[model samples]
Target: MNLTPNRKEHREMSTIVSRVRAAYARIEAVARPEIWIDLRPQAEVESEARAIADRVTAGEQLPLAGRLFAAKGNIDVHGLPTTAGCPSYAYEPEADAPVVARLRAAGAIVLGSTNLDQFATGLVGTRSPYGAVRNAHDPARISGGSSAGSAVAVALGIVDFALGTDTAGSGRVPAAFNGIVGLKPTRGLVPTAGVVPACASIDCVTVFARTLPEAEQALSFMASPSARDLPPLPQRAPGPWRIAVPPRDQLGELDEGWAEAYEAAVEQLRSAGAEIRTLDLTPFTEAAAMLYQGAFVAERYTAVGSFVDKAIADGAADLDATVTGIITRARDLPAHQLYTDQDHLTALRTQALSELADADALLLPTTPGHPTLAEVAADPLGANARLGRFTNSTNLFDLAAVAVPSGKVNGLPFGVMLIGPTFTDDRLARIARDLEPSVQLAVVGAHLTGQPLNPQLLSLGARLDRTTTTAPVYRLHALATTPPKPGLVHVGEGGAEIETEVWRLPAEGLGRLLAALPRPMTLGSVQLADGTSIPGFLCEPAALENAEDITTYGGWRPYLGS
Candidate 1:
C-alpha cells in the first residue's frame, strides 16, 4: 500500500507513532469519509501509539506493534460512540471493548469507528444511517455487510486490519466481495464484552486483513478463554487435505457464473494437493434457513429488542424498516415455537458436525456474488438473504471460518470460505493461508519486485512466488519508455533463457496492472524453463524494431547494473 515506504524496516523497528502516522497518511491520500464513521483526531491517535511505542524502549515486545486498524461501529472504541449503525441508539462507551483493548495493548492503532448494517442486522452494507460503503473495487456494488465498513477499510488499505462482528456472514461476505481475508473466529474465542450483539449466543468478532498472516496476527491478541471453546487442533494438519465440497446441485445459482468460479477454487486447492469429497449440503442449508425463517431469530430480539422498542417509541422512521421487521418478528415468536425451533437447531447442529467429521474444513462460496446497490435496494431483505445462503449456518452450528480471496469473475471479486469445526480456528487459518489464490506472473523489468513499478504489484498485494529462467525461446529487449523497461520476446529459435522472477499477485490485480502499463508492453502467457506457462509481460514484436536487444544480460536484474 506504500503506507510505509520503509515497511520492511518499520514493521520490525519503527516507533508505533511513526507507523501510525504513515497509516494516517494513507487514509488521507484516499480521503474516503464515507468509509469511516468516526476517526480519532490524528494527534490523539499518534499520542496513543507513541505511548505504546515507549514500551519497546523499555524492552517489551509486542506482536502487533505499529499496526493500524478500524473497528466496526458496533465494537466499542473508548472515546467513540457505539452506534451499531443506528445513530439514535448511539452511546458513548467508557472504555474499549475487551477485544479492542487487547489489540491496543499489542500496539495496534485504532483509526476510527466504521459503519455497519443497522444494529448489525443486514448483510447488504446499505441498511445504515451512514452512507452505503461502496465496494472497494467497484463503487456501484454493495460492500456486503453488517461488517461492511470494516471490510472496505481493509480492502482500501486504510488500515492494516479491522475488527468486524460476524453473525450470519457479515464478516466473511464482505471479505469475499472486497477481495481480502476475513477470519470469523469460533464464537467466544474473542471476548464480546462492550460490543453490540446481533444474535448474542452466536455472534463472533472477526478480523479482516489483506493477508492471512496479518489477520492471524490480530487474532492472537484478541483471544479470550470461553467455556465452550474446543481444544486447539493441529494447524493445517499435514498430508492430502480432506476438504468437503458441497455437491454441485446443492450450490444453487451464483451471480455472473460464479458457481464455476467457486468450483475453480476447489480445483485450485486440489492443485495444491488437497483431497476433495463432494457431499449433500441439504442439512447445512436447512439449518441456515432456520436462522431467519424459524424461531432462532428471537435471539436477535433478545439482544436488542429493548433498543428497538425505544426507537419505535421515539420515532419508527429513524429505524431501518428491514431491521425493524426482523426484530419485531423475533419479539412476537410464541414461547412454544421458540422451544421447538431450538430443538430443531440442536438436531441440525448435530447433523452439521457429522458432515465435518471426516473433513479438515467445509468449503463454500463466501457469497453468491456481488450485487449492485440498485439490485439490493430493489429487494432489500431478499438480496441480503441470498448473500447469506452459504454463510448463515456457520454460527448456528458453532464453527470457525476464514474467507480467502479465490478469484475474480465478470469484473467482480469472488472468494471461498474454509469453515471448520469449533476451535479449529488455527487449522482453518492455516488452510486459508495455503488456499489464498494468486496468479504466477513472470516479471521482466520494471515490474520485478524491487524495481520502480514493483509498488504497483505490492499495492495489489502481490508476493514474490519465485525466481526462475524462461525456456530457451525468449530474448530480452530494453523498452524505450521514459523510466526504461524490459520486454521479454519469445522467438521460435536461437534465443536465450531470460531470467525472470515470477510474482504471485491477487488474480484480480491483473486488470489494475494492465491499466497502468505503457504501450508496446502487454500481458501474455510466457513459458518458464520448468515448462509452466502463466500470465507474464510481453512486447509487441514491432516495438523491438527500435528497441535495444539486451539478451546477453539474460534478464532485467543484471541489465540494471548499467
Candidate 2:
C-alpha cells in the first residue's frame, strides 16, 4: 500500500460518494475487525460526504474537502462511542474531540473509530480486548501500538489519514511497523481535552498519513494556540543541517536488519545535506525508561486507574492482564514518589536536550526490530518494552517527532524517527519530508555526471542512483544549443540503446527542476534496458529537425572524443 497524497480539491458529490464506496470495498477486503471498534455504515458516510461536497460547491474553502479519515477510539467522535480499546468502558461523546472537529470543519469526513491497546497501555498492539490489531504488512507480526488501528488504517489505504494519540510512542511505533508517517507534535501544541488520557500531561493527539506533507497539513488545521510560551524558532541560515545519532556501540543490540537500515537512513540523511554527528543517547534512553519503569507509571494509573478499578469491582472488566497489573500496582504509590521522579526527570531532560542543542534533530531507528505475534505472546512484557526502546521518551521531554519509512528489512517496513527540541515541529517536518521516497529520474545528456549542467542537478540535491542505458528503441541527436545537449527520441524501428544516468532527488526538487527546464528539453517516460520506464530527458520532434544524428556515437561522451 503506497500511501501518496490524496488530491485536495472541490470535487463533485458523486466523486466523493464513489471514493467512500471504494473505501468500504477495501475495508471489506481487508477483513480486519479489530481495527475498528465502531464503524459508520457506508451509506451514512457517503451521505455526509455528499453534504460536504455541497458545501464546497457553495464556495467553501475546505482544504480537506475530498479527504476521508478515521479517528482512534480514544479520541471522541460525535456518533461513535469512545472505547479506549475497552468495550466495558465505552461512552458516547456529545461532540467530536476538538482535533476531530477541526478536521471536519475543514471538510474531511470521518469513516469510523479505530482500535488501540486497552487504556493505551502497551506499545505492542496485542493488549486489546477488541482483539489484536494485526500488522497491515504481515498478519503474523504485531502492529506496534497503542495507536495500532489508526496507523494500520492509513497504511492499508482505507482512509487518506487517521487520528491517534501518542504518550509513549502510540503515534510512532505502529507507523514504523506499518510503513506510514506519524507526526507527534510538541506536547500541548494540539488540545487533548476530549481524549481519554494515558498520561494526560504529555499525551498528544497525533496524525498518521501516507506522507509527511499530508500529516503536516492535518496538523496545521488541528493545532490551536497553546499557553506554553515556546521560544521563537531559531534564526538559522539554510545550508547543510547537523543531525545527531547514538554512537554505533551505544545503539544496543539492534536486530541486524534494523541496524543496517538505520545506517542506511543516516547515509540518506547525509546525502540529503545533513552533517552527521555521533552523540551518546544514554540519558535519552534513561528518560524513556522513566516513562514506564519509574514513578511515571503512576500517571497512567492516575489517568484510568479508577475506571479499571470500578470495572474490576463490578466483575464486568474484560481487560488485558498485563495492563491490569501495571495500572493497579501504581495505585498505592506514595505522593512523594511523583515529586522525586519529577525532579529526576527535570535533570535528565536538561541533560538530554542539551545534547541536541547544536543539532537540528536526533535520528534513531523507530524500534529495535519487527516482532512476531508469537514472539510477543511468548514474552509479552519484554517484547513490548523492547519495542519502545527507541521511542517512549519524546513527550516526556516535551519534544516533537516525525517517524518516516526507511526502506525495509526482510520484506517488512523499517522506519527512523527524527526527534527535535520543543517547538521545532516545523523544522523537524522539513527535514523529515526529505526522508520520504525520492524520485527516480533518468537523464540522457546535460544532467549526467561530469557534464556542463550536471551541477544544476547537484545544486537541487539530486544523487545519481545509477548509470544505465535506454532500451534499443531511442535515437540520439546533438541539439543545436549554446552548449551541446543531446535529444533522445524514441524511434521503434531504427534506433539504438542510448546511455543514461538515473538520479534520485526529493520530489519537491524534481518539481522545481521541471519548472526551470529549457523549452527544447522536456522530461517524459524513458524505457530502460530492463523494460522499466522512469521520468527522463526527452525532446520535442520539431526541435530535432536541424539536429545532427548522434546515434552512431552511442553517447555524448563518446561523441565528444570522436
Candidate 3:
C-alpha cells in the first residue's frame, strides 16, 4: 500500500494503456468494492488512456500523461453520473467539471468515481450509504471523510492521484487517516462549476497524491486564470516561515501516540530552521463551529434542502439520519438568525486573521485521533466532530491547507496540517516541503532510475525529485560487490558530469539506508551542478584502489546500457 513514486517505471517501463491495464488489475486484485461507488468500465478507462497516449505520441506535452486518477463521486466526469454520495440524487453530466477537464487535458485518465459521506456532509466516512470507506492501513478504522473515497483510491495505489472536494476538511482528514498528501487549495482557484455543492460558497476541489511535487504538478495545471479569487492568490516566494501552533494546553485531548507524533513534527520543523510560535486558535476554532453549530449550517440546507424535503414527504429518503437531521434543521431556521450569524462570522474571520497575522502558516495535527468504525457508530456525531477538531474552520475562515503525513500513532498513520492565509498556497506548500521529514539522496549507480537498486529507494519512502549530473566533480567506480554496485568518489580534477538522481526519503530512514549499503559504499554529501549539496553514496578510497573507474560511462545505469 506504499504509494511511493517510482521514477524508473514512470519514465521508461510501460505504455499508458499498459499502465491502465496494470491499474485495473491492481483494482481487481484488491477487490474492495466499498472503495468506489462506481468504477468506469475497464474498457472505457483503457480507451481514454490510449487516446491520451496517442496525443502524447503526436508531440503533446502532457505533464500528467498516463497518470491514473479517480474523482469523488460528487465531481462530474463527463459520462459518469454525479452522485455526491447520494445515489438517489445522481445526474449524468454533459461535460467534465472544469477541474476534471483540466486534469484530462493534462493527460490524466479517470479510472472511476469514489464514495463519500453522502452529500459530502460528514467528516467520518461512516456516513456514506455506499459503505464506509475503510482506512487504507486498517480496514476497521474510519477513512475520514467526506472525501473518503478519493483519499482511499490514492492510498491504495489504485490510481496515481485522485480528486476530492473539500468544504470542511474532507480533503485533509482522509489523507491523515490514509498517510498521504492532501491539498485543499484556495477556494475558487479551481472551478467548482460542475460539482455538487456541500457548502458551495466555501467548497474546493482538492487533490490527493503520494507526494507533494506530484500534487503540485496537478495544481499548477488546474488553476483557472479567470477565477475571481477574493484574496487574489499571489504566487508568493517560498519561505523560511514562522509557523504558528496552538499552545500545548490548547491542543485539546488526544491519544498519547498522536500527541507524541504532533510534537515530533513540530520539533522536526524547528530542527529544519522554522520558527515555531505558540498561539491561541480560539477565533479559528469559533469560526469552524460557525459552519455547523452556527447559522452557516443553513448553507448545507440551502443546497439540498428542497430535494431532501421532497424525498421525506414521499417517504423515499434513504439518506443517513445525521445528514437528514442537520440539513432539515436549517429548513425553517430563522432568516434573521442566519443573517446575524453571518455578521458574527465576519468578526470571527477577522479575529482569525489577527491571530496569525505575523505567522506564515499554522501547523497543527490533522485530527485529534483515529476512531474505529465501531467507535464512530456508537457516537457518530461526537466522533465526527472530534475528527475535525483541527480542520473545520479552514474554508469558513478563508484559509488554505496542506495535510502531510507526519509519522505514525499506535502503528497507524498520523499527520499534521499546515495552513496559510488565503492565496498563500505557494508559501504554505513551501513550509510543508520544509517540514517534510526527508534526506536528499543522490544516487548514481544501481539505484538510478530503472537500475537494480532503484526499488530500494521506493521502499524507503523515497521519491525521485529530479535527475541531473555531478558537475564533473565526482569519479564513478565499478565496485567489487556481489550485485556489482557502484561507488562515487569526489574528485577535484579530471572528473566528469556523472549523471545522478536526487531522491528524497524520510530523514529517519537514513540509518536503515546506510546499513543496507555494501561494505565499501558510504553515504556522503555530493555537490550537484547547481552547487546544491546532497547526501549521496560514496566510495572508500581503499575499496576503489582495485575498482574499475567507470567515469567515462557517466552513470551506472547507462554503463549497463539501461
Per lDDT, the best of the predicted structures is 2
Clash tally for model 3:
1
User: Could you give candidate 1's per-residue lDDT for residues 1-562 as a string of tens digits?
Assistant: 2334355344444556666777778878976677888888999887777666666655677767678899999999998988888888889999999999998888778889998888999898998778888899999998989999999989987788899999999889999999899999988888888988888888999999887767887888898756454565646555787899988878888776788888888888788788998767887899888889988889889988998998798775668888888998889888899889888888888887777777998999988768899999999988988888999999988888999888788877789999988788887776675566556788888888678888777756577888899999998988777567888888969998988888886555676578657788888999999998998999999898878899998888888886
Report, for all candidates in order, the number of backbone clashes: 0, 0, 1
lDDT of 3 by residue, 148-246 (tens): 888988888788789998888999999999999999998888888888998899999999988776677788887875586364544535666688988
Candidate 3 whole-model C-alpha lDDT, 0 to 1:
0.84
Off by over 4 Å in 2: 1-11, 441-524, 527-533, 536-562
User: Each candidate: what lDDT?
Assistant: 0.84, 0.87, 0.84
Candidate 1 residue 555 C-alpha distance from true site, Å: 19
Q: For model 1, what is the C-alpha lDDT against the true structure? A: 0.84
Q: Model 2: what TM-score?
A: 0.81
Q: Which ten residues in a row have the lowest lDDT in candidate 3?
A: 1-10
Pairs of colliding residues, candidate 2: none
Model 2: which ten-residue window has the lowest total lDDT? 1-10
